[model samples]
Each structure stands twice: as C-alpha cells, then as structure tokens.
Target: MTLEYLDYTIVFLSLGSSIAIGVYYGFFNKSKTSEDYMFGNRQMKVLPIAISLVASQINPLTIIGFPSEIFVFGITFGFHFIGMIFVVLILIYLIIPIFYENNITNCYDYIEKRFDRRTMIFLKTLFFILGYLYIPVYSYISSQALSFVTTGINVHLINTIVCSICVMYTMLGGLKAVVWTDVLQNFVMFFALLFITYIGVTEVGSFKETFSRASDIGIFEVNTNLDITSKNTIWNCFLSGVLLFTCLIGFNQSCVQRIVSLPTIKDSRKAIILFFIGFIITVSIVCILAVVMAAFFNDCDPLKSGEINQSDNILSYFVQKLSINTRGIQGMYMACVVCASLSTISANINSLSCTLYKDCIKPFIPNSKNNNLIPKIIALLSGVFLICSGFVVEILNSTAIQIITTSLNLVFSTYASTFMLGFLAPRIHSRAMFLSNIVGFIVILGVIVKGQFFSGRVQYEPIEKTFSTDC
Candidate 1:
C-alpha cells in the first residue's frame, strides 16, 4: 500500500517546479519596490489571479475537509453557496470599488484613511488573529497528508520541509511567483481529483451505483427543517453560510489581497466574478468527489475499521487502499495535498507580511516606509511563524472544517459589525465603532478561550453517520 518510486518522483517534481517558479520570478521578474512585490505593481495578469484566488479558497484543508465533512454531515455545506453568491456580489459592486477608488493595497490601510490609527490597528489585530489560527491548520493538514502517503514518516519533519518549500518560493518570487505557482498547483489539484474520481467511480461499478450507495448512506438527503438550533438543516446552513463566507471570503486578507493585486477596479471586479465561477465549479467537483468516496467506503467504514487515524485523513486512506493496483497515484494525491497547502500558506504569509509591515511595524518606525527588503524579510520571518504555529494544531480535537468554521465564527463575531459599519455607515462616529469593535473582540475572545479550555468546544449536534466494521 506504500507509494513506489514513480509517486515520489512525481511529488518531488511538483515541489521542484514550484521552487523553479520562485527562482524565475525572483531573478527575471524581480519586484523593484515593495508594492510590486506585494501586488505585482497592479499590472498582473487577470486569469492567473482568478485561479490563484480559487486555489487559496480551496486549499489542502478543503481538499480533504469536504469529503470528511460530507461523509459525516452530508451536503449542508453546499447550501452555504447561496449566501456566498451574495457575498461575491457585495465584493464586486460595493466593497471592491471602495478599495480600488482609494488606491489601497493593504486592506487595513483603508481603515487609517477613513478612521484613525487606533481603529486601523484594532481591525488589523483581528486579521492577524484569524491568520494565525487558520493558516497553521492548513500546514498541519498538509503534513498529515504526506505522513499518510509514507507510513511511519516523521510528521514534524514533513511539515517543516513542505512549509519551508512554500515559504522559500513565496519569499523569493513575491506575489507573481505565488500566483503563477498557484496556477501550476491548481492544475495538480484538478488532476488528482479527476484521477481519484475516475478510479473510485469505476471501482464502485458506475456513477449511478456510486450515487445510490451515497443515498443509502443517508448523506444524500437534504434536510429542509427550518430550525436555527438544528445543525445540518438547509435553513441553518444558509444563514451560517452567509455570515461565515462574508468573514472568510469578503473580509479575509488573503482574498482581498488578490482582488487588490489587479490594476483597475474593472479588472478587480472581473477577477472576483471569475473567482466566483471558478469556486462554484471547483466546489461542485469536490462535493461530487466526496460522494464518490462515501460510496466506495459505504460498507466498510475506514474510521470504524481503523484504516485511518482520522476522518480528515480518509482521502489518503482511500488512496492507500487503492494503491495496491496503482503505482504513482499516491504521489499524485500527495502533490495535490501539498499544492493546496502551498497556495494558501504562501498567500496568507505574503498578506501577513504586508499587514505586519504596514500596520504593525511601519507606523512605529516611520523610517521603514516604502522599503522593499523589509517586506521580503518580514515575509521570510512570517514563514517561520507559520511553521511554528502550525505545529500547535496537533492539540486540537476537531477536523479541519470544524476548526475553520469555529475560528471564522469567532472572528466574524469580533470584527464583522465594526468593519461593515466603518465603510457602510460613514455618518457613524469612529469612536463609537471602535468601542463596539473592542467590546465585540473581548466578548468573542472570551468565548473562544472558555470553549477551548474551560467549558467545552461549542458546536451543534451532527447527524449520526452510520459507520460499521461489518458490511
């Protein structure tokens, strides 16, 4: 069930290609200023930016997260797409125009102009908190995937190496390198899903057979019960989806950074539209793939049978089960997982560096203004922070999707009302908004602390997934 040399070769080639991209951009397409390093001088290609957005949105945590989630919770996540549509609309017509009109590169930078340094710093702190909580989860997931590929491998070593590779290219190549490598890694993601799906469906007999098995598992049912207290109901998913997607997609620095990277407002809007389209397609495929995995594992549950350590690693377990007949499939899946992590890791690290320099460091030192090397060095340092923080994820008991949703929920509670009121309600006093922001952050931070340590992890009841060892 182990990967052969062919698989290792494929994985290494992917890793090597990503580094090569960094070298090319770092040397040939060098950024002359910090602005160019961050946003490609606002003259970057539109399509690559669009694809990179998709990659960052659907990184490795998601590649495995969706299937694990679907295997247990069904398609509740899909209902969130409805709210996401509206979020995209707001980003395109309403929010993006403000950033574009103001010539704002760092999203937090806009806060300083509209309000004050204090308000900007408050929002910036929330952004940093979100990044620190979630980015490491992605790195943890990537390392777990590699460890699954080669059983008994050192998890920390895998995490360190893979994260280092991603950070190296990010620091060397800048945003252009990140985007182009994303284009490459995104392709790897698509191919991995395709290969697994085709094989899985074939093994399950046919597409029709697979769907029937998924239905038999009861995950195919759409719970339309309209109750806020309910977990998997369509009604709950819709409301939570809108709220959460707004925080994750609308306000997240990673998404905003990509949108601002393009030149014109028109281009930025077009890229957002393209990103929406790409996301829907990619998510549709992931959902379908999850169903396929569910169908294949319908009878003998990997979790119940002890075939995988966790549901998050189920996709890797399934791949290993299929490895007897395949040689290089493990490598392909590994590459896909690695690519997913790299896309988000690099994007957020890049975004993190910008916020650190612009909001955190530069304001204090005023002398570091407009310096390119400082940002690059900050990016490199952020990479170290990402690696160290990522290891902390080992202590969490929930799956990737659960962890992400929980963190985003807390973050939304902290910054959403304040952030929106800041831009949408110009007549509102900045002091009032800042006060609300402080109260919201303190309340949510308390909830997070109590839930994680004192009380218990706050979560809704989930549908019972019928898992058994006996077929």
Candidate 2:
C-alpha cells in the first residue's frame, strides 16, 4: 500500500513523540549516576516495565514472521503457549531471584560472582560481539518494512533515519527514556493490530466463517507426532519452546536488565507475571489475525497469485490491498513495524552499553567516578555502528555470507546452557563450564557445515491458485 501524506504524518508523529520523550528525560530529569542511566536507579514501577518487556521482546520479525507461519503452516505453532508457561514458571522460581538478590546491573555479572572473572570475561566478549552483529539485522529488517510502505524512500536512508532517532533518545534519556517510549509504542502496536484485525474480520463477513474457511483447508490441525525431528509437533513445541525462552528471557542481557530494573525482587517478579499475561494476549491476537488473513485470502492467496515474493510479504500485501480505500491504515502498520524494531534496538543498545561498561571497561578503571557520560557515548557509537552495518548487510546479501553469519549466531546459543550450568550447578567447576562452552561451539559449527554442504535444500509445497470473480 502506498502511504499518502496523512499516513506519513501519523508515522512521523509516533516517531517524533518517542524522541521528544528522550529529550524531556535527558534534559529535565537527567540521570545523575551510571546506576540511574543503566538501571533507572532501580526505582521503576512494574506496569510500564511489563509493557516495555513485551514491546522489546516482540521484534519486527515476530510481528511479521509469526503471522506468516500461521498463514502458511497452521495453528500448531500456537502450542508454544504451553512452553511459554513452563519457561515463565522457571524464570520466577529459579532464575530471577538470583540476579535480583545480588542487585546486579548486567546478567553476566552473575556469572562472575558464581564462577570466576575469566568465565565472565569469556561470555561477555561473546555477548558483546553477538549483540553488535544482531543489531544490524534488526535495522535491516526495520528498513525492509519501511521500504514496503514508502517505495519512494531508499531502504538504507530509512535505516539511517530510524537508527539516528533511536540513538538520540537512548543516548540522551538512557534506560528510562527507552522504557517510557516503549510503553507508548506498545499501545500503537496493539492498536494497529486490533484495527487491522477488525477490518479483516468485517471484510470476511464473520469470525465463524473465517475459521470455517481455515478449517476447510486443514489449518486447525495440531501435530501430535512423536518424532523428535518433526517440526511443530506437540513434544517439539513444548521442549524447544522451553529451551528457547530459557535462553532468550533467562540469559539474555536485554531481558534481564528490564527485570532487575524494578525496585525489589517482588516487583520484578510481578512485572514478569504481567509481561507474560500481556505477551500471551498480544500473541493470541496476532494468531487470530493470521486466521482472519487466511480467510480473507482463501481464494486470492498472494504467494500463489505472485502478488508477493515471500510469505513475510503477506502482511504487507494484505495491508496494501485493504488500504485501497482505507487511507492511514498502511501508515499505522508501518509505524507498528518500526515501533517494534525501535523498541528492541534501543533496549539492546542500552543493555549492550551497560554490559560493556560493567564487564569490559570498569574493571580496569577502578577509581573512576559513577559518571553517565561514558555509557551514553558508548551507546551513541554503538548505534552509529549498527547503522553502518546495515549498509553492509544490504550490500552483501548473499547465501554464503548468510550461512557464515547464521553459524556464528548459533554459537551464542551456548549462553543458555552455560547460564543454566552456572545458576543450577554452582558446584560444577568453572573450568568445565568454560570448556563445555568451547565444545558446544565446535559441535554447532560442525553441524552448520554439514547442513550447508550435505543436507538437501528444503522444498515447500506451493499454494494452489484460485481466482474469485467477486474481486
């Protein structure tokens, strides 16, 4: 859908408001110490942080990717809720208290306290590198979304503008700005989805009809297959979902920073609970939207009709089709995608800055004051680096380069296992934990190489094209 002036105005208003928030906090209630900048002085309330958690966690990829999965695969992916519940329980009972009790700024700090400085240093290096690399991917994804709505604007230019705005707020206002801006963006995202879903349902006639159309195509099947390698099986969903969240929410610095930013462990736990509720609700809405889209496109499936090149384009295609008469909906959807990306990128920038300071810089500068300037500088530079890297990603869009990058990313997954070892098996030797990390990296590398070289390419069944005379 082409965005007109009104749509652009709405999107800019949303983006400008976020920067305005950062300016207000950065100038008026400026953070006094590194602690205040990094942790919000540990005085933040539960509700806003809960909202921020959802905002940060639901990246642009999830906004588009989840809906695509539902549209193409089936509702079987919804079974992840089962795994999410188990992960939340584990985080509340076993993981969060350890970080909260110690009052640590960065999650990696816990590794130092539990094991040794060497182990912390090792993991910190890995995290910093991975964090830096991943931010560019987020920027690229966000730019792609913006490009979809505004075909006149260059994607790289869009990337630079969005990254600059995020850096301005994050560098100026720090964590508090990031959290509050996230709160605002979360509402925009929710409203966008809700409005789109309403329009999609009304256009499809009724909810029952939507589901009936989807069910007719076997989209309601829940795969209960026992095979471990079978994707989307109930067992696979529950087990892999638990492990993924344990890694993502439990060990990741971005998530841990938000949890520990609350005043007390009690409040932190409450924020987590509220986060889960909001998360489940938002996800359910997205899944329902997917079903609605399936019904809306039952006959004119975009992929089959060649209206879009990829499944990920389905949401954008649907928005554009709907926007033929509905004017600002396209802009709102673009804002939603941009909001999701900005929230996640800003959070990572803040968390990575804090982690770099605490784990890498501070140890050597023992007598340094608790100044906020250094972290802000680090965040600014990090943001610039991410923007530059987006250009690199855009230029080097090749399968081989992607394979290498994807393999490197898999190595970071070892953090979850290492974190589990440190938290649950404190009795295990630090040396063993470090060695196991190395071994895990090698094994993952081997697997990636084998898959790239030996495994056959995946082939997907094409959706059958059916024309409707009504259109």
Q: Per model, how many backbone clashes are there?
A: 0, 0
lDDT, candidate 2, at 172: 96
lDDT value, residue 364 of candidate 1: 80
Whole-model lDDT per candidate: 0.80, 0.81
Give the clashing residue pairs of candidate 1, or none: none
Candidate 1 lDDT, 42-98, residue by residue in tens: 888789998998888778767887777777678776787667798888788778888
After the best TM-score superposition of candidate 2, give how far the Cα of residue 150 lies from its true spot, in angstroms.
1.6
Worst 10 residues of 1 by lDDT: 454-463
lDDT of 2: 0.81
lDDT of 2 by residue, 75-159 (tens): 7777866688988888999888888778776787788888777788888777787788777887787788678767779988999
Alpha-carbon deviation at 444 in model 2, angstroms:
1.7
